[model samples]
Target chain A: MNQILVVDDDRELRTTLVEVLEQEGLQAVMARSADDALERLQQETFDLILLDLVMPGTDGMTAIPLIRRQAPRTRIIVMTAYASVQNAVQSLQQGADDYIVKPFKIDGLMLTVRLNLQKARFCEETEAADLDKIFNGLANGLRRQTLQLLSRQGQMRFMDLVRALEIEDHTKVNFHLKTLREAGFIDQTSDKFYQLTTNGQRAATCLSYICKSLEASAQARPPIVP
Target chain B: MNQILVVDDDRELRTTLVEVLEQEGLQAVMARSADDALERLQQETFDLILLDLVMPGTDGMTAIPLIRRQAPRTRIIVMTAYASVQNAVQSLQQGADDYIVKPFKIDGLMLTVRLNLQKARFCEETEAADLDKIFNGLANGLRRQTLQLLSRQGQMRFMDLVRALEIEDHTKVNFHLKTLREAGFIDQTSDKFYQLTTNGQRAATCLSYICKSLEASAQARPPIVP
Candidate 1:
């Protein structure tokens, strides 16, 4: 069962929300204020947080970053009065995943909660796999160079890549080519030209960013003290 | 010229830092505290922010999210005393991009600032191009279904794809195939099979996540009351 934290100052509302959540088979926890929510966040892991925007102390907007820092993976949903729909939008800009207005119907709130939770789960599942593939594909210098070359040239023949990469051994070039092909960063055209797959293009873009940062750092290095 | 904001409680330190940054060809603005920094953030856009972790009111750690919310693209580097190295790390967790120890060398600070600015520029340049390509490629239903089909089947022939997609018109399938190929999502094999490029696979994964969220939202919708 997914764990949820409900942070609101109104005792009656909190009780009602918790009862509704529990009946829906979700594990629900409550906090009377943002401070209380932060404390609980530090001690426990939650799948989602329902935050009230106008808590007495450490209002929801201020608490967002603190809460996010403690639970980076957890989803946050800000609850605000109907009149403060603007604050709800601001809350999203400030890192809250979604928002619900006060006097929200139980069904409407549940729909929003379920949608955000589903998104969270989806992100968690795909992020790791995608990151692993991208990082692993770019780990080698030759691989990185190949991606850059393909990105610039659009496509190349096998021998062309070998010449561009300046690797003497054909087998060595072939080995890296196989690796790239397997990693899904590069593909061969029907006529035998080598080119970046869509992911390869994205990886190449990332590589350029990394190169720029490294170059900036290298250029900015100061002379060592004698 | 890149704009920078320097947030510090100490007037002397703030002035010195701004002078150094100005000398390096960056436009620098000063804030006396986190509250002051937030006010400036609201008024002007910045390429980077140099934040002091400790201040009298609304310290740097708390200011990070607020600053980020205001200027989502700005790079933030936290400044802290040597004794508070841990807080610098915490600042990063709270969304600061980098941190530097105070009572520090001018050369070091310049290096950090330049590196972060380079990264920020790189992100801005690549994010738009990549997102446009991804969104455009996924905009059509046929294109989306084609990606899903390729993702599951690994590779398919032209006729095979037509049959699998359950489309009687080969011309329609061919049109969509050309679209996907141009979008860098698919490649044709030497043996005449069609397969997703690495980027295509990533797109498929994203497509799956989007589908799951839509499905969840649809299921959670309340029944229409007459």
Candidate 2:
């Protein structure tokens, strides 16, 4: 179960939030102030923090950097009143990942909590060395294209890739193929066809997202003459 | 020269910012309040707006969506007192692109202004349909790889691309090549060599940035077991 720390001065709100979180199968802990939250941080690790901004003695804003320092990977979500919605944005700039307004509906709060937890898990699972290899593997355009091709075709023979890529330099293609094989993005099947590995498929998905964003950004641009 | 609108109830700060922007060769206009700023926006289009959050009427936060609706492409940079630095982030979330706290150095302010103007120009110059073509041209992995290959090689013959891409089927390569040509990303020389067009080069640069970001994001991911 995911561990969550709720830092709020209001006992009633804190209790309500903790109950809501527990009902959702999360392990929720309460802290009455920023100082209390810091104390808890030293004692245990938390996956996420729901920090109230206006708590007395070491206010939420002041405690953000401190909490971040002590638990660098913990996801902090600031809780602000509706009138201070702008403060939520400020909290984000100060390093909070997301925010919830006071009088928030249970559904919205739970959704935000779940989303951050999912992101936290992804961050935890990703390794620096694995990322380095993934970067080096996809660094070359040919290699990226190879991954994309395999994603689409599922499997392709050496000659098929050669034709699809249209490179006259067979040795150059072979070199890139070897590089990808070493990076674990692709492997030769029993039938001598190239296909994406599980990791390779993940990389391909990331690539697709990148491409779609590129397209979206492009489409989102205002007309040149406008 | 880029047109800039400075909106603030404080006459002294507005005058100073206007002078600074003018010194940097930007055309600066002034508005006394959010209402005044909206009125100016109606009369003339601006490339950028420097807005102050705490005014007598219609605060900056409330004005953001209104200003955005009136001048969708104009970049808004909220100006806040040093104590309300968090409000800057709130401003950003509310639709402002960037922010600067009061008592900021002139150099930093100029830098921010120039950067926003540059971005505004980019948005102004980008057309929706052009982006569509760029997306379509780069949709396929083979097509994107072909662009990358040409980017590295500068120019290549059809057979050269065939060899470099390692594909045995020439027609598939030919089809993609034609598509890229029609999309205005590449062109064939009289000598039968292919090279990226100016737009294609831009697309290549965009692709390079995307790849680097992917690498960076991968590297930035926290360890799964952490």
Candidate 3:
């Protein structure tokens, strides 16, 4: 469920907005001022904060960065009166995602909330998909070995790799090679040789470096007494 | 031509390697020591650096980060002898891209150089392609204005944007919207309304923020009297 925190000093307006947000099928929480909002934020994670600009203490503008620091991914929409729209626009510069003027229709406020949530979801999903491919490619021991061999030898013919790996089954090696190629870690040349692509080389280099460190640390450790 | 820096204290080996690299159509510059390499780096850019691990002063391992800071994109391949391959491997963690042991075949070294250069080219080309699409999308005033409107209003119908933009020619607005949608900046809803996609929203927010800063800066500037 989408979670929202509505922060305003005006008690009646705050309650009405929270009621309307809840009616729209969102989980809405309310705080009376920025200080109360910050305290509430510590207790719960919110997807969005509907912040009122001019509060008696710790105004919305001052709390914007504080809230962002506490929850980097939490989106904020500052609420300003018509006369304070300029200051609210300034809050956007300070990291507020968007703003809404007071006297905003409940429908307009709801639309903004939905759109921001959708945008965050879309970005997270896309990034996760890309990372999934890269991580899956690196997860296999055989694939990492294949990449390491390529990293050391620069490029290798299929038969050369099969012999170098001392693997009797060429088909198993071929399958691993195919997986690496598809994962964008390696590529085949026109002359039928396989070599690490940029991302592949980077991954291979990092893995090799890590292995080196692990071996060094292991060798440096004192052996157990018999 | 590809530029390579061969940094080694051994005059005979450095000369022989530079000759081989140049014969292979690479522009190879010889640096007798790490200090010499750093000086040459300030004068010219290189695609790759062949660094010798042991030198009279300022060895290859110490030069790795310095070279990286000087030319962040330049790939480094540390050269170590058989006994120091372990130390050379540790250099990878220190920022070396890859390492080659001494008494290495000239062919093997050349292949490593070619592969690293090719990987760099592929990465650059791929990133440039993606950036081209984004830059092309943001190049137009009309498209930026459309994004600004969506940023402020959350979502808009085709006619709503046309009316808001006050553009008499509906076809012009249509063309801009198509471009934005194709570039993945915006998407169409099931109800035929237009809204910013995840990337689109982020881009719009950044553009809006930049516009605000620019306007503020302009206002801050003192006007010149004729």
Candidate 4:
């Protein structure tokens, strides 16, 4: 069963969401605060998180990063009563997969939850096959151009990247390498040589890739100052 | 005739480009320096520019901003004999619509020139309709998230954006806004409302907006203590 984590300070709502998720044919765990959520996330693997944005002591917005760090691959959805567009857009930027307005209907909420989870699964499979380029889409468009360079060249050398892509000193490239390696999306055979971690080179769905390209580019950073 | 300006220190290639454009039944003007190009740009309107990247002064990389400042609508393409992928990418980041390696086949070069000019036309038209959103797309994903809040709400109103987007304070928003405005992609109204300028919103074709957005976020200074 796909594992779901429900994080809310509301005891009653947490219980209700858990019961509902269990009936939906998945394993669900509840955390009462962001700290608790982090604790649970460290020990458990979750496919999705149903988070409350306004929770007391480590709210969804603040805790989402913790959740992300703990389970870097998990999908998170923020559920909150204060449903401004800013909240919706910001939470998504903060790594929440989707947001639900408070006082939502069970049918719509369930549908949203199910669809998000399904998308997450599809994305995971897609990422493993494509090397997380798809996940980069959900996160925001980053690394696609570098991937484009790698795809075209078969591989990128250290000096070429430093000279061509960024004006920063080479020290910055080292930082980017560490980040890419830590993320587990890229593999470095040695210093100064890098490729698309296998999955990045695969040619796949054009539309999804294009859409994700927009997002990935949007989310990308220059690996490191180098 | 579609008028073009050629800016290069190489006397022979500059003359050849002008000859080719004229033979193609388009008007092309030649300049041996970036200063000459800037002066011509200020005095006369041109449809496009053929810029060299490695002249003694005001190279294509440095000249791009000056050209744009002088004639915001003029399309430009950077030319270089030496192909440095990093230089090409940096030129794109700096706002040249397209580039050509030295010893370009006139046919291929003309095709790209045509395509970029057409694209520029289409972009100009699009920007007239919605620049704020378009410019936001040019920024890195994190900054874009904050910019989206500013764009969607029409007025940032400070508190809502901070809480809704989960940002800490007023300074961060302004910092991103300053970059947006400085790039000439955005403008703040008399009442201090930030909006995207026409070119700022629609000028991005090579996905530089993602980098712009990320840079601001990564460079975001911490909130000041009162």
The whole-model C-alpha lDDT of candidate 1 against the native structure comes to 0.72
Q: Candidate 2: where are CA atoms >4 Å away?
A: A82-86, A132-226, B1-226
Q: Write the per-residue lDDT of candidate 1 for residues B133-213, one digit (tens) a residue.
A: 555666666786788777756688999889878999999999988988998989989999999986676566555333322
The per-residue C-alpha lDDT of model 1 at residue B188 equals 87
lDDT of each: 0.72, 0.74, 0.70, 0.60
lDDT tens per residue, model 1, A1-226: 7899999999999989999999888889899999999877656789899999888989989998667545655788888774332354346435566666678899999987887777666555554455456656665667767876777566899999899999999899899889989988899999999988866765665543333222222333443221
For DockQ, the strongest prediction is 2
Show how many residue pairs clash in every candidate, following the order shown.
1, 23, 0, 24
Give lDDT tens digits, candidate 2, residues A15-39: 9999988987889999999998898
The candidate, 3 or 4, that scores higher on lDDT is 3
Kindly report the root-mean-square deviation of model 2 from the true structure over all alpha carbons. Answer: 18.6
Q: Tens digit of lDDT per residue, candidate 4, span A65-135?
A: 55654454567878888775435545654556567778889888888777666655554544334323333
Error of 2 at A183 (Å): 3.6
**Tens-digit lDDT track of model 2 for B1-226:** 6889999999998998899877767789899999999988766778889998888889989999678655655788888884343465456545576777777899888877776665666554563435456656666778877887787667899998998899999999999999999989999899999999977876665554344223323434443321
Top of the candidates by TM-score: 1
Worst 10 residues of 1 chain A by lDDT: A210-219
Worst 10 residues of 2 chain A by lDDT: A208-217
Candidate 3, residues A174-224: lDDT per residue as tens digits? Answer: 998888888888998999999988667655544422222212113233432
Query: By TM-score, is 3 or 4 better?
Result: 4
Off by over 4 Å in 1: A82-90, A126-132, A140-177, A193-226, B1-119, B122-226
Candidate 3 deviant stretches above 4 angstroms: A1-226, B82-89, B127-129, B132-226
